[model samples]
Target chain A: GAGVSQSPRYKVAKRGQDVALRCDPISGHVSLFWYQQALGQGPEFLTYFQNEAQLDKSGLPSDRFFAERPEGSVSTLKIQRTQQEDSAVYLCASSLVPVGRDGYTFGSGTRLTVV
Target chain B: SQQGEEDPQALSIQEGENATMNCSYKTSINNLQWYRQNSGRGLVHLILIRSNEREKHSGRLRVTLDTSKKSSSLLITASRAADTASYFCATVPGDAGNMLTFGGGTRLMVKP
Candidate 1:
């Protein structure tokens, strides 16, 4: 079975530039999540989607971080006006349900470097 | 925010030796889970122990949770070089969703 997948394993952008990270969740998985992990730290939640409907965005650092999952399977996390503070790995995960009885499967993530 | 804290921050052990890592959290949780990451990229789910269940085992991996202490421990018996990676403990509280709060992981290096 195909697990979650992310594109452009690595990206480098200049300050003030915008970047987009993509995630492909497993088929029929209703719950999707985005997280940001800085160097030597645990991942922090960004947003969550259930069947195309975003349930939470409180973890988003600021307005510059936006996510969308139109088809309920594919998701995108876009960061605007990149900053060195934004340099980190963005992780995507999906699970069968929201209550989390079944653990999530994560992608390799995209490492972004803002110079 | 990191849901829990793990220590010793880094550990070095040899093959055939036992490796132990500990984690502690502040909030009430439905379950606690462990994950392993290699090179800090993708993380693989290792095990999950419910708050009510004090201990659970999968093969050579043993996870023990102490609700009163709000802590958990992961013990690997006869570790291998493949076990060298960062291990994290995630606390899934009663947030109505499975959103996890992870901790700063413990880096384990196994010298074979």
Candidate 2:
């Protein structure tokens, strides 16, 4: 892909419903990251992956939030029994390098609205 | 918790003027990065400055970092209406590997 791609640009889910957001990072990128951006706020880190390995899950808000990168190319963020507080934009980014020397490429994001 | 914080939650300026946004972070960092986000869109990487470097430049953007003060600033010269967007500062905490912690961000509005 030319850039990071995210699915379901917008989503509306009931309070208890489950939602899955997908991300297709730039081809051959080795690192992936997921973030949640609340209204009028900056994106907050959710999780990080180095290829197929889930190196960090410390930022996941709760057990309800689960992310997987089984193939190391595509990733998904799943939120179970979504709550009102889950209403926000879910962003996915990928980096070419494992460290901070190179910047990341971001997806347009999935805007989830929990009512 | 967010590791960085940007001041001047909102900034308004006219085209051709210079806009400056400041960011402060807690704890040691490997590097600092700036990003821009237009309304309802994803962020675009602007510039990055490593801890060892005090300043960096890219086109109309100039970034300065002061590790001693744990702060960084982004200066956009001759701003344009196209530059109107929210600017954020993200840090790679020395202890946090590749995960980046972002600040609240500063919203800049450049009127043409």
lDDT of each candidate versus the true structure: 0.92, 0.94
Q: Could you tell me every candidate's TM-score relative to the true structure? A: 0.97, 0.98
Candidate 1 residue spans exceeding 4 A from truth: B95-97
> Compared to the true structure, candidate 1 yields what TM-score?
0.97
Q: What share of the true interface contacts does each candidate keep?
A: 0.77, 0.74
lDDT of each residue in A9-37, candidate 2, tens digit only: 99999999999999999999999999999
Off by over 4 Å in 2: none
RMSD in Å for all candidates: 1.0, 0.9
- What is the C-alpha interface RMSD of model 1? 1.3
lDDT of 1 by residue, B1-65 (tens): 78799988999999999999999999999999999999957989999888789999999999999
lDDT of 1 by residue, A1-115 (tens): 3999998799999999999999999998999999999999989989989889999899999899999999888999999999899999999999988767768899999999999
Interface RMSD of each: 1.3, 1.2
DockQ of each: 0.78, 0.78
